[model samples]
Target: MNGRNPILAEAPTEPMTGISLLGTTALLFEAPGETSLAVQRRIWSLAREAETWPEVREAVPGVNNLLVTWREPPRRLAAIVERLAAAWETASPLALEGRTVELPVVYGGEGGLHMADVVAHTGLSPEAIAEIHAAPVYPVYALGSHPGYCYLGGMDPRIATPRRKVPVLRIPGGAVSIGGAQTGVSASPGPSGWNTIGSTDMIFFDAARTPPALLQPGDSIRFRIAGVVR
Candidate 1:
């Protein structure tokens, strides 16, 4: 776990940096090994540092990855890549303590259109699945996919389901779904490849408000079992 964190203090040596370019405009850096909260903390640390640089327009954090967008596409591409890599080597964990949100979710019916799919995959009853799913206080890892959507961590791997081979054309807001080892709630109606097992009515995005996205990195979500549809 320490090897995965960018913190040179805890980790005697950093994992080999996964560096590449996103077209000509931005650079991508992926922390090696499986996704973990420790790695994401380092990402937060790196994002904080990189965002202040004169060359960076924004430093976006994803699951074990970071995207460094430039203020302008620099001519010194090699030099920029080097600098970014150097920054990652020195980054430390930025563990954030954020607010917790409890969402009342309805599992397995219209809201959870894909509950049967999950049941079949896990060989677990809907009741058991719902119990397992709501067991943890999941941390909001990153905000991506769509406006206000939160990528959550800490799902019980027993119920881990893969993303649908054929993506749903549209899923309503607050659609709770599991994709691979991760789980998240759809912020708005849109196409998704994840399996929707439940839903909550909470408004994840509000354009009319400040800091539009409902959840920030490090915040936690507790999924309350509002009801279970047969």
Candidate 2:
């Protein structure tokens, strides 16, 4: 919610900053807390600048932070931060541009093994739940936790349910799941606490393919129920 946008008009009376050990380099940024939004905005602003800088190798945006990875042309964190701050001061945010994709899923019964649990928690029928989930197009957030993992946002509050009590160890690939207010597609067989409401046949990441991950940040995804749960 806070990464690219800052809620406060000005920096708080006391601002915090720090460094994180990532790989062989250190990432500097404002510490996480109530001011996370402000920090994230600064990070985005800096990342936008770093994008133009030759020293920075990669600038990855996250839920509330921007990761600047550098290589070869060595530079200090302070100098990078200064450059990023200047960039944030001058550059206007680019328009939100991404593709919209519709995904077909099978919900309920066996397909949505967690439907009963969801109904018990939200007091909604399986049909109602399906309708609510399929109502809106979810925005792709950050892709992580697993390769090709599509981190999505924007779900009907009615269908926003908690994760499973215990995660299944080996959820087959293409598993469509919901947790809290987000939905995602599992790109590989792995364990997760998210509620598995459906499954997709789409291959998210393939080694043999030119590009691996099917979903990217800022992309929009829609859900369409194609079959019954059983």
Candidate 3:
């Protein structure tokens, strides 16, 4: 195991280009190679290109994957799949220079209900954990889980912690959390399997506003240490 900490996120069991059916409504394309920003950019590139296809209703990006939804499964599915593989070969990283928003976080006390759990797992002090978590300018990889929520990338690996065994019934909005190799702040929470270590007061979604989500893929979040709980 190279004597590395076992808390690290596991490697992908499936590799190379893979296509699967998410029911019959959509086809999911999982990109091969390491899960890095470059790969993510390639997924972004694929999404942009795939969206223009007459068959595609929408091309949604995920962490190292793309979901292309359609009104109905195309009749020439095999040909479409072949074309998708061909498209992936030529797809290149699309640099999306987006807005950067800094969020002030409170890294313990009530906000961090699971702070002790993370401390137990990672063997890092809360302060150290906060510092490591705050170190990176995380990119909004994609949005999922709930409305206006974002899936972020670029967390430091030292503090990697597995998702909770059992999800909490509900976590407060603005919860800054970690689940395995990634982390993000919850915009509006319901249930989450991630470890909550901190929180912010940012209102990420407002239905009354146009383009309700505060951040999109390619946007950035720099977490500022507003306060740390001892």
Candidate 4:
């Protein structure tokens, strides 16, 4: 992943670069290079605008791309693509006032199963690691990996660690882990390759809630050390 920090929105100056078909019904719109929040916001804006069109069924935004599925097979794919291109051209910069969620974490103990591994790789003391990791107010790039899970960006590079060679069979929900240049919180108990540094009590998903996901793209997160969990 590039060193670019994720943000909610930035000035829309970049142009729409490329488009590709996914299977038969989905169109993947691509921006230039490694995904950034600017590209993400643009994709999100375009996806939202595309929702108004009759041809669109769903518009899923990724890091640097937007996957749009058609409501029905169009008579001419070329024409639909052309319209989408037009929408992309005129789409405004995203202006969402997303919420900032504060998650209290218990770092460096049983909850942080891979804390020692991270210390070895980064050569940073456990306390230093906790300080650096908790410093940044990470941005939600997208929701993937699991239900209500968040792919956050803006982790301090000093604490960056690679994913495990062999994934753990089961990591409990609320596990705060770092994989490659990105970091995220697992929403449910599942297999993972990311190195767990801590855990939070935040409920990421609830079926009974109006919005099942506790976090959404464009939201911000600030992690605070809430004592150690032995």
Q: What's the lDDT for candidate 1? A: 0.87
Q: What is candidate 1's lDDT per residue for 1-230, written digit by digit as tens? A: 53432222322133335876676567789987788888889999999998998988999998888989987767666666667778888989998999999999999999999999999999999999999999999988888878898988899999999899999899999899999998999999999999999999999999987998888999999999999997
Residue 87, candidate 3: Cα error in Å is: 0.5
- lDDT for each residue of candidate 3 in 58-128, tens digit (9 for 90 to 100): 99999889999876656556666677889999998999999999999999899999989989988999999
Model 3, runs deviating above 4 Å: 1-17
- Over 46-165, each residue of candidate 4 has an lDDT whose tens digit, in order, gives 988888888789988777777889876555676677788888777766855689999999897988999999999999888888889999998887787678998787888888899999
For each candidate in the order shown, give its overall lDDT on alpha carbons: 0.87, 0.68, 0.87, 0.82
Q: Model 2, range 41-64, lDDT digits (tens) per residue?
A: 454555666777777778876655
Candidate 2 positional error at 41, Å:
9.9
- Runs in model 2 with CA error above 4 Å? 1-15, 18-24, 28-48, 72-75, 85-91
Give the Cα error of residue 194 in candidate 2, in Å: 0.7
The clash count for each model shown is 0, 1, 0, 0
TM-score of each: 0.90, 0.77, 0.90, 0.86
Error of 2 at 9 (Å): 32
Extract clashing residue pairs from model 4. none
TM-score, structure 1 vs. true? 0.90
